[model samples]
Target: MVSPSPELALHGLVLLGTDTVYAVHMPTFTAPHDFQAVLRVTLDTDTYRTARKRYGTSALFTARPRTLLLKDLQPGATCPADLYFGRFGRDGEPLGEVSITIEETVYVGHPAAEPRTLRYVLFGREQLYLSHVLTRPPDFDQVVTAQLAGEWWASGSGAETPARTVTVPDRPDDLTGRLRPGEQLTADGTQLQVLAEVYLETADLAAGGV
Candidate 1:
């Protein structure tokens, strides 16, 4: 209903050790009531194309800056480099972009462990939240349709809020990524889950769900 303020900063999570970056946009509009959005992971075209060539294109979808999966990466390894989130609308309209110039990596148990965590920041302020490194390349079957608030908007400046995150398999018990209609998953102080049920309002306007 309202446009995001230009002053708002983009905040989200980056899958540590990979080119995958999850830009946590503001909540989207849902049916009965608005619900939280999911961790929207995006990848550069070259990186995405490489994954398609290595892992097969059957599971992937086409987008300018693609989303999902990184190939031949090992856990705990430093990411290729800082990444950017090129914002887009549900109708595939252009929004704005933000880049993660600085990053700080943190480890839980051992310094060298699968699914390690990292934070993406800019000027000491967190631009990205804590995210994990998958033990192996994520399977396309990992993608699941869940209820989310529709549309992407800027996260107006403020403290980072807890939001929903997609389930990544082969991690810790909590990271196992499973959700019933009402269950929730909490990781690294981040709350994630599937909302009951809702539809994107933009479907009434344009094409594609985004």
Candidate 2:
């Protein structure tokens, strides 16, 4: 369950640069120092994503020499820069801490059927599926979508009214709520919907499907 807290996200941004260059977070300066800007990015290392999982690292970088300025930081306005991070400012105030638990993957998927061919994907390959599966009372087939003309990427925060936007492809499928799992719901024959559900085999169940 990835309920993101503003504070931890800030820390994640900071830790992203500790080993090599210092990272900065929402920075405030006094007087003349304001004219100088800082770079939002630093020389990143290969182990970049791995370092993001650590906690307890301070989100506040002490405004060091290694950090460069962008264009003289502005009041009430900031640019995205790295090299540690200047943050200019944060999107929202810190909301508090988040805890995560990791173990073998629990998954939901549909068995392949004729016309659909065999198809299975790692659960929650995209954040959207995770949001649905891990939240209170998960339900599937809850989205309206069509087959895409070609491969596409979904964009946008998963919480908004039009939360998911399908990318444009060579052709597009007509949008329809009637789309069903394993149905070739797209135009180019490249898109299909599959019903993903948590499954239990007979061996895992108590006697007589109890």
Candidate 3:
């Protein structure tokens, strides 16, 4: 990637350094916040961190990611505070320059992963959730071997769902976690099945109403 020109003005929190990644905890704000917004960086070059979500801000957000390229920038580097926000892999690039008085300096080191926002490899449908985000993708054209815990939710009746861990080894693209009925996950180009799906219906949007 080419160096991020000093002409664009960034518009979010600035890192004192690039030696570490930042975990953002924004206060609950009303609509229009675009909470799932991805954090962009400009330490001589442009890079981005993936937002954990693309919708509501109920979930904790991990913003201000560290890109692999930062390993080269020396400490005390400066960055402008005119960052831009937009859809993932879409538009929202920022530009312009800032006066020395307003520019922020790099105080930390670059995070291990580029696009430094941390992620979870969790699995859930409705009430269920994924355990982690770093869970590696299964090898191509191969069945996935994995372990999952499903005893967290007390959501069953008569025969309450047992709280026991299960082995989900070598199952092709087996996906677990919050998902809608129409959506599906794929492995090795195969569509994964939805063991359990969860969702809510609102006056503005419903499963079929949307």
Q: Pick the candidate with the highest lDDT.
A: 1
Whole-model lDDT per candidate = 0.26, 0.24, 0.24
lDDT of 2 by residue, 117-153 (tens): 1122212211211111111111121222222324332
- Model 2 segments beyond 4 Å from truth? 1-24, 32-43, 54-67, 72-210
lDDT score, residue 202, model 3?
Answer: 22
RMSD of each: 17.3, 19.5, 16.8
Better of 2 and 3 by TM-score: 3
Model 1, global lDDT: 0.26
Which structure among the candidates has the greatest TM-score?
Answer: 1
Q: After superposition, how far is residue 24 of candidate 2 from its true place, in Å?
A: 5.8
Compute each candidate's TM-score over C-alphas: 0.23, 0.19, 0.21
Q: 23-72, model 1: which lDDT tens digit per residue?
A: 22222122211112123343433553344345331222222223222221
Error of 2 at 123 (Å): 26
Q: Which stretches of candidate 3 lie over 4 Å from their true place?
A: 1-68, 72-82, 93-132, 138-175, 178-210
What is candidate 2's local distance difference test score? 0.24
In model 3, state the lDDT of residue 117: 23
